[model samples]
Target: MTQSTVPPLKVGLVGFGYASATFHAPLIAATPGLQLAAVSSSAPGRVHAAFPDAMLYATPEALYACDDIDLVVIATPNDTHFPLARAALEAGKHVVVDKPFVLDTSQARELIALADARSLRLSAFHNRRWDGDFMTLSQLLAEGTLGRIVHVESHFDRYRPQVQARWRESGAAGGGLWYDLGPHLVDQAVQLFGPPATIWLDMEQQRDGALTDDWFHAVLGYGTMRVVLHASALTAIPAPRFTVHGTQGSYVKHGLDMQETALRAGAALADGWSADTSDGVLALHTAQGVVEQAHATLPGAYTQYYAQMRDAILHGAPVPVTAESAHDVLALIEAGIASAREARVVQLRGQV
Candidate 1:
């Protein structure tokens, strides 16, 4: 495949809710190779309010039919992700599906197969992998500063004691904390340590009126190493972002990176945006006393995802987030649900 990097690709987004409005639009607008060509939403006002120059479609099907759009980004809800993405690929467009790529492994695999048959680029928006704290941990692991990490812990906790009346809190296909936040934790674990031998999951609805699980605790077993991933909306005081233990020493980091907040607050992402440090605390033990490092907060670069997607489409660069990797994440999520349902450990077969 002869890929050219000189030309930018036209990108049509399929939703205008929080994910699209807050995350997708800004990043797509900021990225160089991708233009915000069109968007589909019944809430045309929402799309028009944010992207006045972009064409507006009444439905995703209409968006997919746009001849000028080179890429399609599905930032719609969880249940609609698979079909919408499949439609885009079948329409000969490169596709980017937001997190939890789909509700099940079969859906993910099907999309993979379809994308492959068409030779089109397919990617998942596993953006949390680029979170500042995660990057720091990845750096430490790469440098062997943590020295053969035997244990890893990641938490995405919040203080929402009351379950809000939203689709996410509803007892539906993609509802609840597990589907909402599980992908981030699972993907991070997979990214750092590979797949696990088994997974032990404890999921429950902690709030009084909640219909779905609001809390989740999963232990992904990697033989000698164990990764403990947990998320709860009831957490008033959130736990550390990362707490890693290795044979030689340990490293602990507190607080989520500020880029998401910055994006939500409409901050411009120029001037080394991701390299900024607003929140990070790292403590490592070394022979030269306890080596402590505070990561210069990296600007969250959601735009990088689109840039990579553009490269993959125009230049045949590797898709930043592949469908197969996302399938594995869905498998783990299914296994987690099963583990919690049966009150037994889910035996995972894949390695990394």
Candidate 2:
């Protein structure tokens, strides 16, 4: 029998909040081999307004029951990730859960095992890996431009002094800045330097009337190397997005990826869409003195993630972010929380 070409993968997105509306849906629509077939959202009208042709389901259970959906993207609240992903996997659909894959490693491992048993692809949306500045830093590290890295600092600070009345700002499970932004920083650090030997964390509720923690500083110790990840809601003057120090030099980048701002502003994907205009400073020590030069930022490609996911489902390519890698990030998050609660450094036992 002659083999037939498989049609585009039909995707059902769970949730229509900032992550789904601003990132997942848009990228899925833009990718070549994926179709935004349906969505499960509380606000059906909003989903229709944004994606006029998409079929809307009132609940994820209904969307999961639909036979046409080949893939499921979970962009709901962090606490809802585990159950929804498990259900999607049980339905025999490939899955993509947004970062902080689940609340803990056990839940992640369960989903991983189920997906593997079903021979389905499972990925985490660690989109910041495609950030323009992070791409540049990856290149520098790979090329040995920074020599032996000794210390690295990453910040995801914002100036939201007023606390909003939302689940993220409430005392609910999987709420707070650590669960909100800590995954990005922790994932980036793990990508750069693998799992740390020890984890130390400090967290606080800095803003007035803040119910959950809005500030966090985590230190991932890799023997001689130290990776510092910090995020806060009350940072009026935010620090550099990334700072790296090595035996030979230092690199500091000052801006976040532009794609997010553009997406929030209802901008479409086009030429130069993810380009970062802000240049980073790279300082090298020379015989004469220190030489500082501005390094041009690389163009971010968040859409590449969805495209890769498509290929992984259609052509047996590797998923962009593996379930195991995401599990490692979750382990780090758990360790950080424990360290904060116990006021001691938590030791990691196994590989990421």
Candidate 3:
């Protein structure tokens, strides 16, 4: 069969909130072989602003029932991720869920089993792996520019003095900055260095009117290498996004990836966006002295996630972010939570 003859994969986005509007809907629309078939949102005007011709359903189930929607992208609250994904899978549709895949590893395993039994594609949206800075850092590590790894620090700090009124801060089962940002950090670390041997965590509710943890510090041990993952809502002074110390020297990067910021600013597609401006400073120890240079980050393309999702559904390719990998990410998150509550390091011998 000819490639062009196959119909475009139709996607049903389950929400039109910040995540759906800012990330999923736009990326799905931007990809060539995928179409925004429908959306389940109470705010039709909001969805119409972006997808003028696309269908709008009053509820997600209504959108899922339409055979036109071959895939369902769940961009709802953290607590709803599990049930919504399960519903989408039961409707005989492929699924792509937002990160922190679910509250625990058990839920993730259930979803994974369902998708496998149905012979359908299922993936978690660990889209931060495509962040320009992260991609560049991955390249450097692969090329051995950083020599043997020693220590790593990753921060996703932000300046939010006042805790806003949202479900994320409602201290629910899967609320707080830990679930919101920890998934990204933990997934990135695993991508770079596999799973860790042990993890110790400390979490706090530092911001005013904060009901849940707004700050967290997690230390993960990988053999001799130590990986520290942290995120806070009370940082006036921003920390470097990444800091890597190796035998050769260090690579310190400041500023977050620009793609999310740009998409929120209403860009059509964040392609070919340069990273020269927010380059990471790479320092190497030399015989005479240390040499420092700015390392350029690869352009971030979140569009790749949907593109690969399209391929996996249409061409029988491997899923972009497998449910099992996301399950592993959840293992680390749950471990961190346990570590914080018990005030001890959690071993991952059988956890993952």
Model 1 has how many clashing residue pairs? Answer: 7
The deviation in Å at residue 97 for candidate 3 is: 0.4
Off by over 4 Å in 3: 274-276
For candidate 1, the per-residue lDDT at 263 reads: 86
lDDT of 3: 0.90
Q: What is the TM-score of candidate 3?
A: 0.97
Is candidate 1 or 2 superior in TM-score? Answer: 2
Q: List the residue pairs that clash in candidate 3.
A: none
Clashing pairs in 1: 194-352, 195-352, 274-298, 274-299, 275-299, 276-297, 277-297
Output the worst ten-in-a-row residue range by lDDT, candidate 1: 1-10
**Compared with the true structure, what per-residue lDDT tens digits does model 1 show for residues 24-124?**
89999998867898998879987888889999999888888888899999988788998898889999998999998999988988999999999999999
- Candidate 2 per-residue lDDT, tens place, 135-219, comes to 9999999999989999999999899999999888999889999998998889899888888999999999999999999999999
lDDT (Cα atoms) of all candidates against the true structure: 0.85, 0.92, 0.90
> Could you give the C-alpha RMSD of every candidate to the true structure, in order shown?
2.4, 1.8, 1.3
What TM-score do all the candidates reach, one by one?
0.94, 0.97, 0.97
Write one digit per residue (lDDT tens) for candidate 3, span 145-168: 889999999999899898788888
